[model samples]
Target: MKIGLLPLGRPTFDVPFAEEKLAAMLAALDATGHEIVGPRELLFDEAATRAAMAGLARAGIDQLLILQVTFTDASMAVAAAAGFDQPLSIWAVPEPRLGGRLRLNAFCGLNLASHALGLNGRAFSWLYADPGDDIAGDLKALLAGERPAGRLDAVPVATRSPDGARVAEALRGQKIARIGEHPVGFDTCAYTPEAVQALAGVSVDALALDDLFDTARTVPAEAAAEVRRAAEADVTGLDAVNQEELDRSLRLKAALETIRESGSYNAFAIRCWPETFTQYGGAVCGPTAMLGEGQVPCACEADVYGALTQLVLLEAAQAPVFLTDLVDMDAADNTGVVWHCGQAPISMRDDTAEATATVHTNRKQPLLYQFPLKPGPVTFLRISQAFGAPKMILSFGEMLRRPMAFTGTSGVVRFERPAGAVLADIIACGLEHHMALAYGDHRATLRAVAAELGLPLLEI
Candidate 1:
C-alpha cells in the first residue's frame, strides 16, 4: 500500500525530541515496504500543511497517515479528513516518563485528532506506539481499514443523594466566565451555548484575553503584594524564579478576583497559553491553582465544559477539583498518568512534598504549581460531546503515591478496571482529553446528577 505521511507539531513543545522521533518513525514506515510520499520535515503551520496536503493528493496515495509528532490542535487533522478521499490513519509515539518535561506529547495530539474527526463524522484508524516497537501488525491492520472498538460499562442505577436536588438547583443560573477563545484546532474545548444552557441552565460570558491583561496591569501594588504574601505562605521557592514575572502572575489572581466578583461567576474557563507568555508577560497556572483551592474552579485552555465538569465534581465531593489531561497509560503497570502544565490546586498536594513555585517547562515563565497529587481514592468526570452527543462520563481510580512522572502537577492513577481497558474505551469513545478529578468516591452523587439531567452515563 502507498502511504502519504504528514508530520504535525507545534513549536511550544520540544522540537529536537520530536524531530528525533520523526526520523525513527519514518524508518519504521520505510521498513514496512509501503511506498511513502510527502515531505520528511514537520509541518508547523497551516501554510506548510496545506502545501503538503496538496502534494500528497497529487501523489494519489492509498492512505493518508498523520504522524502526530507533538501535541497540536486538531485543525489540520480535520482538514486532512475533509480534503482526502483515501483512508486515514494516525500514529502517535510515546515518550519515556523521566520525571521531567513531557517531550513529544504525541498521544495528546492523537486524542485531539480523534475527537475532532469523530465529531466531524470521519472514520479513521489510530496507533499508539514507540517508533521501534513491533507494530508491523498494527500497521497492516490500519492498511486493512481496521478501527479499534470501545467498550461501555453498564450505567450504574441511579440512587437518590440527599443533596442531588440542591446541587442541581445550584447549578442553574450559574455563569462561567470564559476568558478568550479556545486555541485554534482545539475542538475539544468548543461548546455550543444552547446545548450548555439547555443541559445545565448555565450561561456563558465570553471575555477577551486582553481584558484580563489590562485588568492585571491596573491592579493596585498593595493588592498584588497582598496576593504575593498569601502565595508565599503556601508555595515555596517563589524568590528563585524571575521576580518581575512572579509579581505579574500574582496580579493575575487579583484581576481574576475582580472579574469574578463583577460578573458573579461561579467558575472560569481561561485560555492559558502562548499569549499569556508572549503578550501578557506572565503565566496563569499558579493563579488558577489558587482559585481552585479556594473552591472556585478554573479550567485551562478555555474549556467551558471542563469548568462545568469541575463545578459538578466540586459540588459532589465538596472539595477542590483539578482539570487534567490523561497523558500516559500502561497496562503492564495497571496505571495511567494524569497531568497538566501545573495548575493543580495546592489543597490536593501530597503532604509528603511541599508545593513549590516553578516555571513553565517550555515557556520558562514563572508561577506554575509543581507537586504530585495526594494519594487516595479519586473520581474522574467529564461532560462530553463524544460520539456527537452530550453524556456524563464517570470513572473510579486510586491515586498512587509516586515520584513526579512529568513536570507540572501529575499523578499515577490505578483505575477500578484494567488500565488497558480504560485506554481502549477512551480511544474508542473518542472522549475528550480533559477530565475533572476530585479525590474521594462521588460516583453515586454523579450518577444521581446524570440521572436528573437525563444523560447517558458512560463508566469506563
Candidate 2:
C-alpha cells in the first residue's frame, strides 16, 4: 500500500524531533510491508505543501495521513485532497508540554486544522498522541484493505476482452451466493447454476423469500425508523406516491441491513421478484436500491453474474451504485425505459430537491420513489459473462422525466446514435433489452480493474 502524509502547520522548533517522529512512523509502516513519503521534506512552505499533494495525486497514493503541528491552516490541504478524492485520515498531536504557552499553541493549531478538514466534508480519521505508540500500526491496518463493520463499497471485476484459457482459469474457482429466484417470464436474465459455475468460477447458493422475511422480523424499531428517515430525506417533490414509497423504502432498508448483519457475505446477488412484491406486498424496490446505494449491490432476477458486476463496480468507484433493468427500449429515437422491482438507493436519485416517498403494498418492501428522475448526462454499464467470457457494455445519454399521467416513478432515456442504427446494435449485443445503470464517469477506473484482471473491455 502507498500512503501519503501531509503535515499542515508552522514548523516545530524541534526539527530533529519532527524528523525522528516521522522516521518512527515510516519505520512502523515499513514493518507492515508498506511505503511512505515526506519523512524528510520540510513541508512548512505553502507551495511545497501544494506541490506534494499534486505529486501524490499523480503518483496515485491510495491513502493519506495528515499530521498537523502549529500553523493551523487546513483549507488548502483539504482542497487538494478533495481534488484527488482519495481516502484521508488526519492526526492531531497534543503539545509536548500542554501547560506551557508554546505547547498550547501547537495543540490549538492542530485542533483548528482538523476542524477545518471536518467542515469540508472530507472523510478522515483523527489520532491524538504525544509521539509514538500503536497509532501508526493502527493506521497500517486501516490501509491494508480492511472492511469496517457496516461499511460496504462497490468492487470492480474486469472482463473486457477475454481469452478462452483465461476465462476458464478465472471461473475454475469462485463462489457466488445468489438470493431468491428469477422473475417469471424474464427467464433470459436468470442464470443456470452450471452456467454460472462454468463461466465465472462461481458457486451459486439459492435462497428462499422466507429467508429475507425472517431477517426483517428481527429488525430493531429504531434502526427501521432511521432507514425510513434516510430514505424519505432523499425524495423531496412527490405529491401522493412519494409517501407510499418512503414507507416501503424504510422497511426494505432496515431489513436489508439486518440480512447483511446476520450473514457472512462479501458480495451477494438477489432477485427482486414476484415473491418480493406478492408476498411482501410492496416490491423490494427501496431496499434493493439501498443495497446498491449502501454498496452491497443486488442484481434483479437472481442473476449472480449481474451481482458480480455490481460488486466489481462497488470496488472500482467506492460510491453509491445502481442496478437497474432495461424494462423498455425505443430505438426510433434512441430511447429506453429503465425500471425493475425499484430497489435503488434514494440518495442515488440525482434530484436536487427532495421528493416524498410512496408505499405500494402490491410489490416488495412497498417503498415507491416520488421524485423527478435526475435529468442530465449519465453513463450506463453492464458487466456479465457470456460463453465463459466476461463482457461489458457502456453507453451515455439523458434521462427524461415521466409524463404527468405516468404511474409510479418512471422515465425515458434518450441516447445519442446514428439516426437508424441503434436498434440493430442493441439486439446484436444480445443485451436483455434491460441493463444496469450507474451515474457519473468510470472509464479510467473501469479500465484499470480490467487491466488488473487481464480481461477484455469495451466502451461504447
TM-scores, all models, native as reference: 0.97, 0.53
Candidate 2, 325-411: lDDT as tens digits: 443343344565554434555655535534445554233235655434566655666664322245665666677654311223444
Q: Identify the candidate with maximal lDDT.
A: 1
Candidate 1 lDDT, 27-130, residue by residue in tens = 98898888999999899999999999999989989999999999888999999999998888888888888889998778788889888888888888888878
Local distance difference test, candidate 2: 0.53
For each candidate, the alpha-carbon lDDT, in order, equals: 0.89, 0.53
Quickly count the clashes in candidate 1. Answer: 0
Q: Model 2 residue 15 lDDT?
A: 54
Q: Which stretches of candidate 2 lie over 4 Å from their true place?
A: 1-177, 192-204, 236-249, 350-354, 359-365, 385-390, 398-411, 451-460
Global fold similarity of model 1 (TM-score):
0.97
